[model samples]
Target: MELYGQVLLIAMPIFLVAVLAEMWYGRWRGKDTYRTMDMISSMSSGVTNVTKDVLGLSISLLTYTWMVDHLAVFDIKATIWTYLIAFFVLDFQGYWVHRIAHQINFFWNKHAIHHSSEDFNLACALRQSISSFVNLFTFFLLPAAVLGVPAQVISIVAPLHLFAQFWYHTQHIDRMGFLEKILVTPSHHRVHHAINPEYLDRNHSQIFIFWDKLFGTFQEELRDVPPVYGITRPSNTWNPVKINFQHLWLLAKDAWRTQNTRDKFRIWFMPTGWRPADVADTYPVEKIDDLYGYVKYESKSSGALKVWSWIQFGITLLFLMYFFGHLGTIKVPGIFLYGGFIFLTVYAYTELMDHNPNALGWEILKNAFGSYLLFSTGDWFGLNHYFPQGLYLIAGYFVLSTLVTAWFVRKGITPDNFVTQATKSQSYSTLNTH
Candidate 1:
């Protein structure tokens, strides 16, 4: 838990650095929004999506931990060089996993959630299906187990690799020049996120761009060919479950409707959105042009006010970091605290991302569940023995989380409120033009 907390602590500072980098880039490019609602929407949604991905990865970690423990093949004496070798090998394996995810139908169904965003941002990088656990387990851990790598090493290194990739998801950063030739930067990744025909299935590297170049999957971002972000099909909103499973359901329906077995198999195995020939003929295709282009409602905030909002967000992030740090050291109560914090954070961020004001009810329900867990679970679900103080930390976390949610609710509809208005305005404009 402390390790995870530390990773997040490290990530926050990196995130701030990335934000500053982005701001500088934006200013250099002479880009400033009269309305910052879109920025808020993207940030909020990206965070929610990443949270879901982390939760899914956590489950996979638990399974991997159990397997490693059961097999008893851990190594403590391995040098730093060995760990480095393992990291590259694991990442090399990830490249194929990522590639197959794009190529194979069943895998793509789950992976499609990540591509659903029209906007390429750091948060969107985190949007993946819970079912992706199957791929994570089978592709990465199985090989390590075969090589007699210890479970402890795999467990530690896997998250490290994952956490390292978080900053590469944003559109805020540009090409890293010579480093961009070798390492996967924001620009390199943004190209991968693009739906442009030339961009699709390119740049499949996780930690290093060398794999993509070696495998002939690398496509450098060209100014002449402006990248179009998002999947071929766009998701309606930021509902995590829906985003994750929408393609699965679509494929299942397509398979069921197809009379031929081969067609059914193709529907599940081929690239995403490939239906049976008969269905494709009947279903009109609408290829979206700009994935990041969404209806933006206006914001009334002045420049000073916008700066103030960002400052508030920074403060909130600082508090969250401290809170997570404290919770890491405190056992017994840590379980409830960790779970409740994650649940609330993911839930709130999801609502904020979707631009839906109605998410308040869901947030309330989440808090209610957290309260129930803390009050009812005496053991903090098995962490009690770790700390001499026991569940006091749990009680404090519960109160703090509750207060935070109260404050979030008090802030009202958030930036999404303006987004909804922009959508309405677009609708009205269309009608007037007609």
Candidate 2:
């Protein structure tokens, strides 16, 4: 956990810089693809995912060590050749795992956050999954395990392989001539992210473009059928935690509502987005039909609110960095507590971003929890050791956050009213990237 957290301390900043650079490049090119709230939502999703990972809040059905121990036919040494082979096998493993997430009904919940953004950008690339509690696809590395690749080698290659995919998530880059055929370029990824009928589930490879080609899921970007991003059903709210489980919640409700036991049993593994026939007719979920004409999700945000949201996001990020940097010092339960606080910070601010009236309530709850931690632990998870007055400042921030949230709530601030006011004051136009 400490090792991963330390690595993230270096990686996260580079990612943020890349996202900011992409935003700047887009504006300069007159093709801005990022919305403020959307970017925050995406970043918040990333925070929750990383926090979950850093805290080791997952269970793998079969570990790589276990696989290699029993399945190896030949022992391989950790050389340059070993890493190259590991990278190749990891790419193949990523392809099938990614394809499964798109194909199966139950697994789609683990991946839906990635496709939730209507606008594609580097920030949206950060929208990974927190709902994937079980690592069910470890056996996909059978080839590597059989070749006696060390578990340490797989562990090292896995994160590097994941980070390598981050750059191609941008809309700023066009097709990369010959590289498009060899690697998953920005063009290939755009198709993978698009919800248009033509591009629904094509291009499932991570690094190698050949996997999709070999598997018959490859669809080239066409001139006429422009890519339309996001899922068929819009996740209207700005809360990433809520978005992570929205599909699973629907599935649970459907299972309970269905009369046939068989339907309940079959719904989970049937196919992605498949609902029982009776449930579909009785309780239909909203899905996009006119791909070009459907409205994108938006919430009313004044300049001040946007500024406050950024502050909240920035502070939450700082808290995460502190936790990551001090993992070994903070110890077990302390680290878990800090992780919980991080989750609450994200949930509270994102609720405000969604303009939910209950946001104030969540803020109060967050402040209350933070206060308890401060009083009971005698510091903000050992932050006082770094700065003498750090705890006091955190206390002040909590008090200020609660007050601001209450003021917003009492002023009748909601998506309905605030958006109207924002529109009359300033015209915010969606860029025509197509």
Candidate 3:
């Protein structure tokens, strides 16, 4: 956990720099791929994913260490060849894991957040799953176990393998000449992320492009066909927490609604986006049918609302940095408390971005609870040691943010306002014509 925190301390800034650089580069080329609310939601999704990981909130169905201890066949020595073998084994395992997530209805919920963004940018790369508590991919590591790869070796390489995937999520890089055949380049990954009919489920490789090629899932980026990013069913909201479980909730509802006993039992393992026949007819969910008619999910936000959302995201990020630095000192329960605060902060601000009126009330309640917690605790998990006056600044921030949020809410600061303005203008013009 400490190691993860340390690595994240370095990684978080690098990710920010890369995303910002991509945004700037896109504008330079006269195209803006970064939407403010979409980017915020993407970054918030990353925060939840990392928080879940750093808190060690996962259950293992089978232990890799146990498998390595018992299934040793080769007793391979720890050398460069073993590391290469391990890397290939890991990538192979990753490909299947990625494939199943898209193929199965139940498992797709955990992965849907990654493809939920309409715009493909580096920030969207951070849209990882927070609902992934079960570690059921142990069977994929059997090749490594048979070869007698040590658990220590896996622990070292796993983070590197995951981090290796982050760079390819960008739209900036084009086709690489030689590396195109070897590694998973940006073009290859873009095909994977696209929802266009041709690119729907192609290119499931993580680090290597060969896995997709060998498995018959490879589709090269063609000049004639452009990739349209995002899933068929738009989530229509900016909350990552909600996006994580939206599909699962649909499955649960279908299981309850369907009269057929067998259908209820089998719905989870059915193909992706399948619903019980009766339930599908009675409670029809609208899916995007026409490519030309598709509208990206967006809310009307005044410039003030946009600036307010950024301020909230920036504040939550600073608090996250503080939590990571003091991770060792904060007790387990305190870790959860602090993490919960950060999560709620994300939920509140994101709800505001969605232009949900209820968001103001949620934010006000969250701040009230936060203020009381600090007043009673008198410290932010040992942060008082660094700066005695910091708590005052934090308290003032909570109070002031709540007030600012309330003001925005009272101003009718959603896209709905634009519609209202249009109606009033039309009415005045009609009166003048009469």
287-368: candidate 2 lDDT, tens digit per residue? 9998766767778777888899999999999989999999999898888888888999999999988888889999999899
Candidate 3, residues 35-151: lDDT per residue as tens digits? Answer: 787898999999988888888889789989989989978777788888888888999999999999999999999999999987788899999999889989987999999889988
Residues 232-274, model 1: lDDT tens digits: 7666555555566777877887788777888987676686557
**Which 10 successive residues of model 1 have the least lDDT summed?**
425-434
User: What value of lDDT does candidate 3 attain over all alpha carbons?
Assistant: 0.84
**TM-score, structure 1 vs. true:** 0.67
Of 2 and 3, the candidate ahead on TM-score is 2
Query: Model 3, stretches more than 4 Å misplaced?
Result: 413-434
lDDT of 2 at 402: 99
TM-scores, all candidates, are 0.67, 0.96, 0.94
Residue pairs with colliding backbones in model 2 are none
Ranking by lDDT: 2, 3, 1
C-alpha lDDT (0 to 100) for residue 352 of candidate 2: 89
